[model samples]
Target: MTILLFGITKDIVGSPTLSVPTSSVTGKQVPKTVRELKQFLGDTYPELNKLSSLAVAVNHNYANDDDTINSYDEIALIPPVSGG
Candidate 1:
């Protein structure tokens, strides 16, 4: 699955998108839900844990923790914003 990164999240991840593993050589699973995705990202990029807020979106709609994420689903990560 690919995660669209925005704002600080993009900078933290070092790209505007992130590719998450849905399957492994051994046929293991990874991040089947939004919550698991977040944890996976946090483990991969500890800086994500420092953010005050992070929103997950699935197919342009806000996603809850329990929301399932398929390998072909569209996901986005929106981080907190600050303005003058």
Candidate 2:
């Protein structure tokens, strides 16, 4: 799956886009859920785990914890924004 990183998420992955391995159940790179993606990100980049409450978007839409993702779908990691 290709995960798009925005805001601070870009710093976490060190890239705007990432090609992640697929899940066995879906036979695609899509992450099953927000939590699953978090775990995946943590595994791939342990540094991201230090951040609190990361957010996710699937197919240009914000997704919840129960949201299921598809391999061919577009996913984005949107970290909390901070500005003065």
Candidate 3:
């Protein structure tokens, strides 16, 4: 799965995008839900866990924790934004 990163998420991950391998290749449990995705990312990049708020978009739509995800889905990581 490819996840596009935005704002602090990009900074935290140190890249504009991240590539995650599928279970078939990694032989590890793949994240199947938004919540799991978050956990997977947070575990890989601990800085992500520090964000006060982070939103996940799947296929251009904001997704809830229970929302299902597949390797083929488009995922984006959006972080909190503040401006004066």
Candidate 4:
């Protein structure tokens, strides 16, 4: 599965996307829910935990912790926005 990145997230991740395995391979762990995904990402990319407010979107809609994530699902990380 690939997780799209936006704004600061992309900068921190050093790319526009994150590739997470759908099945455990080479000791990699797969996340099955928004919560798990966040935890996994936070562990992998500690910088993500520093965002003032981060949002998760699935299939173009905001997702809750309990929201399910499938191998083929679309996921993205959005950071806080500010306007002048």
TM-scores for every candidate against the unseen true structure:
0.90, 0.81, 0.92, 0.93
- Give model 3's clash tally: 0
Candidate no. 2 TM-score:
0.81
> Candidate 1: which pairs clash?
none
Which 10-residue window in model 4 sums to the lowest lDDT?
Answer: 21-30
Q: Residue-wise lDDT of candidate 3 within 1-84, one digit each (tens)?
A: 999999889888889999987675666578999999999899899999999999999999999999999999999999999999
**Residue-wise C-alpha lDDT for candidate 4, range 1-84, written one tens digit per residue:** 998999999999999999998888847568889999999999999998988988999999999999999988899999999999
Q: Model 2: which residue pairs collide?
A: 1-29
lDDT of 1 by residue, 1-84 (tens): 888999999999899999887777535458889999999889889999999999999999999999998999999999998889
Residue 84 accuracy (lDDT) in model 1: 100
- The TM-score obtained by model 3 is 0.92
User: Candidate 2 vs candidate 3: which has greater TM-score?
Assistant: 3
13-46 per-residue lDDT for model 2 (tens digits): 7788998878566453445777787887787789
Give the clash count for model 2.
Answer: 1
Tell me the whole-model lDDT of each prediction, alpha carbons only. 0.90, 0.79, 0.92, 0.92
User: Ranking under lDDT, best-scoring first?
Assistant: 3, 4, 1, 2
